[model samples]
Target: MKATILLFASARETVGAPSLTVELDENSTVGGLRSALARACPALIPLLPFLRIAIDSEYARNDQQIIPHDAELAVIPPVSGGSSLEIPAPP
Candidate 1:
């Protein structure tokens, strides 16, 4: 199956492309895509470990299978969401 993966943030900067279309196995997983992506874009190998795979805007696990459908795939870079505020416990 062939799918197009969108890139964002650091991932976009790393590849220098907004998106990529690659052929993958029908039962490919997020981890598998990482491998194929590394081959397609050698520069991304280092970032693969840190990048997160999103299917339809939702985070996907490495072992999660890439469903054969019109799902939006995105390579999301680590985002710093700022430190959390302290919350006091109530009795």
Candidate 2:
């Protein structure tokens, strides 16, 4: 299966690309994608723990199945803000 992965903020910089196209096995899980990413981009290995993944624009869990033919996938790192709150502040 094939999917497009989008990187955000530091993840974009670390992976050295804004997005990439990848092929995976059918019914691949989010965790499987992370392993594939680490193989494709060594820089992503250490940071995987801090990253968040999305499937079709929604947050995804490690066990989540990737619908490569039906959805877009993204591997995003935690975004930082100047504010003290750990969660994203309202715009």
Candidate 3:
């Protein structure tokens, strides 16, 4: 089976690509994909645990089965702070 993994943020930087295709067994799960990714990109091993995986736009559990042909897998790294605003003082 072949599936495409969409990389985001740190994952994209680490893999040096926006997306990648991987070959797996017919019974591959999310966990299996993780292992395959680690093998393909050693730099991603440290960040793998923190990544949130989504299949076809839905968050996937580690053991969730992956349907290579129909799944749109994405690897989302942890997000940090963004913009913030302060409350105005009472006059």
Query: Which residue pairs show collisions in model 3?
Result: none
What are the per-residue Cα lDDT tens digits for candidate 2 across 17-90? 89976777898899888888887788767677878998988999999888656787777666555542133433
Clash pairs for candidate 2: none
Model 3 Cα lDDT, one tens digit per residue, 16-86:
99998888789998999999889888988888877889999989999988975687899977665562222
Q: Point to the candidate with the largest TM-score.
A: 1
Q: Give the TM-score of candidate 3.
A: 0.83
What CA root-mean-square deviation does each model show from the true structure?
A: 7.9, 5.5, 8.5
| TM-scores of the candidates in the order shown | 0.84, 0.80, 0.83
Query: What's the residue-level lDDT of 25 in candidate 2?
Result: 83
Q: Residue-wise lDDT of candidate 1 within 1-91, one digit each (tens)?
A: 8889999777788779999888888889999988889988998877777789999989999999988568899998777576222221332
* Model 2 regions lying over 4 Å from their true place: 81-91
lDDT, candidate 1, equals 0.83
List the candidate 1 regions with Cα displacement exceeding 4 Å. Answer: 82-91
